[model samples]
Target: MCTLTCIAISLIIAATIYYLRFVRTKPKLDIPSRDRVVVVSGAAGGFGTAICRDLLSRFNARVIGLDISKEVMEKVYSEELKQYGSERLSFIECNICKLEECEKASERIAQILKEWKTDRVFALVNNAGVSNSPKCTERMGIVEYPEDELLDVFGSNLFGHVRMTRLLYPLMKDGQDGHNGAIINVASVAGLLALGFFGFYTSSKFAMVGFTDSLRREMKSLGKKGLRVTCIEPGFSKTAILNLKPQADTEFGRIGVIREKKSAAILRNAQPPKVIGDAICEQIFSSNNLPHLIIDYWYMRLVYLFLYYTGLDL
Candidate 1:
């Protein structure tokens, strides 16, 4: 018993040291100048709003929010415009699933940058996404999942970002106006672990991770060393995606699935949206060539790392 206790204490110390040295270490990269701009999709949502506000308030960055809802965009615009002038905060209505719309939005963003007297886009945050609902609520399992909803999930979660990246890459290229840029893709832990009931959502995130990895390698090989691509895989948070409403009490609710219940429990200790926002900001400003950032509790982080290293699928 004494030996076991000593071993446990040693493991604890080792974990603490690892966390301090690696997990908590800050990047040494310089922050982008005030003249550069950052674009965030789904800017009305919890994570998007937090990131935009952080970049604008902390870094003094010009932030442009893109969302499908004109009303929500107007609301955010009004609130943020009051705190930070139009020069610091702007909004563009974009349905990312549509390639043409993405192209048009890209054009408008280019104009905005030109007007601001800056010819570069510092980063693009692909944060827009939809989550799996109750078993029969349209976006559930793969076998019975509505074909249209499935398509929409793939479109918004994966292809939409693809379209946005394709449209914005020219502006973000290494030599595009002498600016270095980053692409921040918000994936999920579900992307790494195949949750039982969240087949559609998991599948989409998996594809997102794959795409980010491929893009990062391609950029390096193409001599665009100034352009960095990163994937953020966050554990469950208290976001709108949780949808813990009256429906959540039903038998077919999110809790109906053991996997979701476990996720929800972990989210009881989940980090807030601001944590994710701050991490993204750090990634952008840091000099490290980090390809993946996992934001979660210590235990979740350990589990993910162990599973990843062991090639074990959860």
Candidate 2:
């Protein structure tokens, strides 16, 4: 019994030390110089605005804000442009879900670069995304949801970003001068751990995570060393996504009502959007190459570790 106890304690200590030394250590990034351009989609949203502000204020990088909602985009521009300067900030009202708009936006960005005498796009932040509609209170089961709604979720959450990446890859690929580029995709912890009532959202994010991993491998195979791909999986955050009506009032509430309350309470202490923005900025500036980043508090990390080691699905 004494030997068994000692062995278990040793294993626990080893695991803990490994997690602390490697998993929690932030990598050092090479900061891009000023005068570079970064394209940020979903720029009007909470997290998007934070990323735009950080890039502009910290790196002085020119930012193009892309959004489907002109009103929201204009609002963000009006509030942010003056502080960041009009020359450094611009807005493109484009729906990323549409191929035509993605192509046109790419063209417009290229023209802007030419006019500015810049040669390469420093980074692309694929942040624009949508969750299931608040009105989707129907049975939380997959078959209960409308097919059209599922398509919309997938379009906004996954395919739109794919389209944008394809359209912008040429400018971001390794250039003659050997300037490397970065692509940051904002996924969610739900992408890694499934939630009961969030079937559609979880599925979309899971697909995103898989797609990002595959893209990274492909880039390496093609010798695109300068280009880096990163996927950020953020835990519950204090964003509009959690601002839905109380779960008890919704139709899907019947499925996981208790878990909903618990989740809401936990999310009450969730990290702010700025935390995620800072993580992205770190990735952009860091010289170290990391494929995935989890931006959440320590407690969440512990939970993830437990589930991962136990082979439990959430």
Q: What TM-scores do the predictions have?
A: 0.84, 0.88
The 10-residue segment with the lowest total lDDT in model 2:
244-253
* Tens digit per residue, CA lDDT, model 1, 85-105: 777877889989788889889
lDDT of 2 by residue, 1-314 (tens): 99667656655764694486347766675665487788999898778988988888877788888998767787756866667765788788898877899899999888877876886788898998776753454435555677876887788789999998888898877665555678888888888777677658889998999988988788767775647888988888888777654444445666556667666667788889998997887787665656877678866766655555544655
Candidate 1 clashes between residue pairs 3 or more apart in a chain or in different chains: none
* Candidate 2 residue 76 C-alpha distance from true site, Å: 1.9
Segments in model 1 whose C-alpha atoms lie over 4 Å from true places = 1-21, 133-139, 175-179, 224-226, 244-259, 309-314
Query: Candidate 2 has what TM-score?
Result: 0.88
C-alpha-based local distance difference test score of model 1: 0.76
Q: Which portions of model 2 show Cα errors greater than 4 Å? A: 1-24, 134-139, 224-226, 245-253
Highest lDDT model number = 2
Candidate of highest TM-score: 2
